[model samples]
Target: MDKCGSAMEFLENKNILITGATGFLAKSIFGGENLEGSTKCQETLFTVKSSKRDDSFGTQLIEKCIILIVKVIGKDLFQVLKKMWGGDFDTLISEKVCLVPGEVSLSEMGLKDSNLVAEMKNQVELIVNLAATTKFDERYDVAVGTNTLGVKHVISFAKQCPNLKLLVHISTGERGGLILETPYKLGESLNDIQGLDIATEQRVAEEKFKQLEESGASKEAITSAMKGLGLERAKMYGWPNVYVFTKAMGEMVINDVKNNLPVIIIRPTIVTRPSTVILLDMLQVTVGYATGKLTCFLAGITAIIDLVPADMVVNTIIMAMVAYELKPSNKTIYHVGSSARNSMRYIDFQRFNYQYFTKKPWINKDGDAVKVEKVTVFNNMTSFQKYMNIRYLVFLKGLEFANKVFCHSFQDKYNDMKKKINFVMRLIQLYRPYLFFNTIFDDTNAERLRMDIQKKDRETETFLLDPKEINWEDYFMNIHFPGLVKYVFK
Candidate 1:
């Protein structure tokens, strides 16, 4: 096949049903409002910076003028055109791409329109199941209802689809154990519970939920009970959390129902915008004024963070979909992560943060520059808690005591601060496990697929999905960090 033909043929006229169509990956694929609000300023800044290389003000001026024109024309018109043209802002939106609005957790995927569901069953060729509850501490009932039962619904729908070619179910990279490129039977390992079938396990979960409901527990109490149940089940099953446990159950459902059907499970690790604090700091140091040193201490400084840019993860999804189409497989599992290919050490990440902050301080909303003197990295939880207690907790407690004694009205403010501190502490506890995670996902299958595409297709066709081509430092400093600051922090 020719380059373009090979790359676009599979997706070309293939009716696809993307469950989580409003999510980040779907938005990038279909085009949506990811670049609004404070991002407009970042967009202008990026344009001006690009023009600097050519030493030309004309390019910058033109971009600014275009921005003004866009404002006058309104954002809605621009968005319509952008969506119609797709990501490149040139190619027309694939005629075959159609949005199916429904909830995955429902029986018929929450499809109110029976005709639409029938049409999907008749016409849809590929079903990309990306809908799932991603919360780490989600309640057991909600997690299983959405993540586990949701998969069963999708599979039932897929089974009805006469032309169904592939079912791409998005899973997690962390399966609470060493993950291999090949698919392994559940409970095959020593740590896993033996002979715990999905049907029996699901029944047990439902029975427990029913008992809780029958007990006439308060809503909050029921929720807490469910959460506790999920944690207990996960621990018993050798899974990390309710989210992963339910997701694994979802995969098992697919395995059971998807007889003789082509299916691929993609397990993606921490998907986040790259940290750009260092790059922004560098820019400030080089272009703006600096202030005196200020010290900042951070927890999880020596932890290892396995993260892949959201765009990269999306790219892998699309490419994997296409690759599966080209080479039909009964079952294939791909670990879409950067750990094996391009790992970033937490200590080094912190170092970059320190370097950036020390050189150029962050500007607050009030236009005051915050200086950075030094940063202390806490690898151990004990050290982190000690620092927090000495630096913040003790001081805050003193303020609270004074407010209670002298200024009773001001006590509310102190209470609010304490609540905020408690919130932060809870978040720290929630994410602490991931910060020190040591598993490296085996990506042999994914890498092989990339190589196959590289050999068969032109560089332009495969460049975006090529994981080996990523430069960790460059990507973090340029694209990831800048994007995070502009879109998220803003």
Candidate 2:
């Protein structure tokens, strides 16, 4: 359309193409059907591996959206979606949403014709790049391939697009592990990254990578090579961790090449679920480790989990796009995270559990209700487990004393109980690293700009980022627990 300032005006008639259309951030924006009066727009999603990856969840999202959209338009939108993607992912999409499917990682996106690329260059008005390898434990080589080189492709494609207006790149809020006690202060980047040309570096790196891979180098060897790349990056840009290191490279790539085209960088922190999305519980490695390890928690455990609900995180991303597009700023960054105002500590979760489940309704087998005169929540988990062992020894001695006196015994019951408690404590310790640590993300910019609503050019309401928005209590009691029982166990 015409040049405009606000996202509403900016997005008017804009054909927006998004990579990582199935990721946490994009999933949040795709929830646009939930928004009241959000007029449908022409959009295409690029998810690299639709069949190979853990995309069952992503497919569900597509299905849900298409269903919702069909209800709204009261007409067939499936054909439109099919033409966009060049396939029938209609079952994978919801309400007749226009969808274009292809892997963002590969050149030409695995499409049959070069014309599709030409078509994308012609029709698409805006692009959102969210595709990347977020796995921190990923082999460094693969991470760089997807996160670094894939980004270069996205940038190159965007540059080729004749109608491109704004290319909004969704990045992680913690681009670097660098933390300042204050929010506004920018710290040293992991790499110097000064005067870096992302596209050129990618071309050179791709040759080197192919050479090494062709020789059949071990994954470990390739990883070492990638780590070496990180050093070169660190020397250039000052960031730590492969994920952030490449993302830092990504940010530079967009900044260096982008001239007049407006770009918005939206970063979100570790995404999880307090309520909405189902958390895994089948594998002993499940969210129910809270309940699973309750006994062990009376013993000391370390390791804190860093997470936020998926919906909240996505909500922020959508808000950032709207706010930044509405914003006059060009090539700006918005850290869309929760550390600034909302801090949910592991200590609080520990205290909440100890106060309820163990005390009043804590019933052992045989329908016998036993109540200790008083129970205090243990802060040091390891010490609590040690204390439990000591108590177990003491109880054995007491049983021996009573077995001789009463003549009949409680030996078998006590041993089984002790064993269970011990197992529970171990489970709690297993969950420690994620539960106790502070990756404490800060998003001062995102919080302010996101969730602002206007009606007739006047401010109507503002949004709040409270974990309390969805009941944390029911999250554990009903949904978290029952969902585990139904979906995971089954």
Best by lDDT: 1
Scanning candidate 2 in windows of ten residues, the lowest lDDT window is 179-188
- Against the reference, the lDDT scores of all candidates come to 0.62, 0.52
Q: Give per-residue CA lDDT, model 1, range 1-490, as digits (tens).
A: 3533554454555667777654434444433222211111101101001222333344544554454334322333246555544574432322323333455666877665577668768877777787788887788877887788888988888889898888888887455346687654544322556775666667777888899889998888888788878877776766767888788778777777778777888888876632222212132221222233324434455445677655566656667776776666543888878777777777766556556645445666678767754455577788888888998899898887888889576787788889888886866766666767777887888887777776766632533555566676666546644544554342
TM-scores of all candidate predictions against the true structure: 0.75, 0.60
- Stretches off by above 4 angstroms in model 1 are 2-4, 32-99, 175-178, 184-190, 195-219, 273-302, 388-422, 459-462
What digit string (tens of lDDT, one per residue) describes model 2 on residues 356-399? Answer: 44443333345544332223445565666667768676775676
Off by over 4 Å in 2: 1-14, 31-39, 50-101, 106-112, 173-240, 274-306, 351-440, 451-486
Q: How much is the lDDT of residue 56 in candidate 1?
A: 39
Error of 1 at 382 (Å): 2.7
Candidate 1: the clashing residue pairs are 275-481, 276-481, 294-372, 294-373
Give the Å error, residue 359, model 1. Answer: 4.4
After superposition on all C-alphas, the RMSD of every candidate to the true structure, in Å, is 11.1, 10.7
